[model samples]
Target: MATVDRSTLAGRRDAAALLLGYACAARVSELVALDIADVRETPEGLLVTIYRRKIKTFTEVAVPYGRIPASCPVRAVRDLLAAMAEAGHTSGPLLVRITRHGHIAPPLTRGGKQIGDPHGRMTAEACAEIVGRIAAAAGLEGRWTGHSLRRGFATAARRAGATLERIGRHGGWKDGSTALLGYLEEGDRWTDNPVTGL
Candidate 1:
């Protein structure tokens, strides 16, 4: 599935966006705000540094290489950056804008200041659209939005018995326990359900 996306400019871009967004629990703004320089390779995994108003200084998060190579965030970002550099992009926003007509090519400069070219930092709406497109392409029959990644991550982690503090830190939320409990409590019904210890 992901192998096919690596075949084109937009495919690679969207693939990287999906995997990285899911793995990092990134907000759409934080996702699109990334630059080529924000990613660096580490001995264990790739470190992505995000600088947002909420996180005044900067935050570095490690994204490991998953067993599935095609779905690995580290590989996806590395490949995307390599493709971008090969296309002459040495700087600027990590995600280049794609047109409504679905065109992807190499015209963006380091800062995407090329005249009349729209390949630049993507908008939040565009990010949502990409997530929807990726979901549909993967044969998911329902609607999905940019927040799905974060939501899905929280659900998956809770199911794996991750503590609220761990989940909050992983998601870059200083105090997300209240919000997470709402999502988790419903699934954690073993304590109240009669089926437990039966």
Candidate 2:
């Protein structure tokens, strides 16, 4: 029952991360590494260009949400862009810095030019920590991770009556089966259970 509540700053950031993860169905690493230019508003919804080192491929994916609204992923992207602009960042990486003091800041290049930080992009460890912190803040109890956000979206969308084919396509899976597998395996385990449903 780890739902994202976008009220506080941390909550908003965590919600932004969750929404990005789910909307793109992106791996946490990819989600964190995303650059400002990588996202664009589309007539259909949003288009996200993903680069994965392990996959060694660039993927163009679309997230179909009704248009770019204030509450949508586009807003998150805009906020990030604004933050970067405020920090005088023009390019390089995206996720920025995760300070030991728990503060998030922009990264700088060797020449002291403002640059985005790839190191702060959501890693498995960072994802785990964020999930735990968000869960605790929301007063929810359960195992959670970056993968949970993606799985939650699939599962919740399916339970809300979204078609598997639609979810699969939006999630950028090669097939409905693959999407369904993650949806069922990772999502259903939490939502479908008799107890602790969100």
RMSD of candidates 1 onward, in order = 4.5, 6.3
Off by over 4 Å in 1: 1-4, 52-57, 99-119, 183-198
| C-alpha-based local distance difference test score of model 1 | 0.76
TM-score of each: 0.80, 0.67
- Tell me, by TM-score, which candidate is best: 1
How would you encode candidate 2's per-residue C-alpha lDDT over 10-76 as one tens digit per residue? 4445656666777777777777777767877776667789874444677777766635454476566
Tens-digit per-residue lDDT, 49-92, candidate 1? 87644556567878888888978888888888887788777788
So what's the TM-score on candidate 1?
Answer: 0.80
What pairs collide in candidate 2? Answer: 96-117
lDDT scores in order:
0.76, 0.62
lDDT of 2 at 4: 55
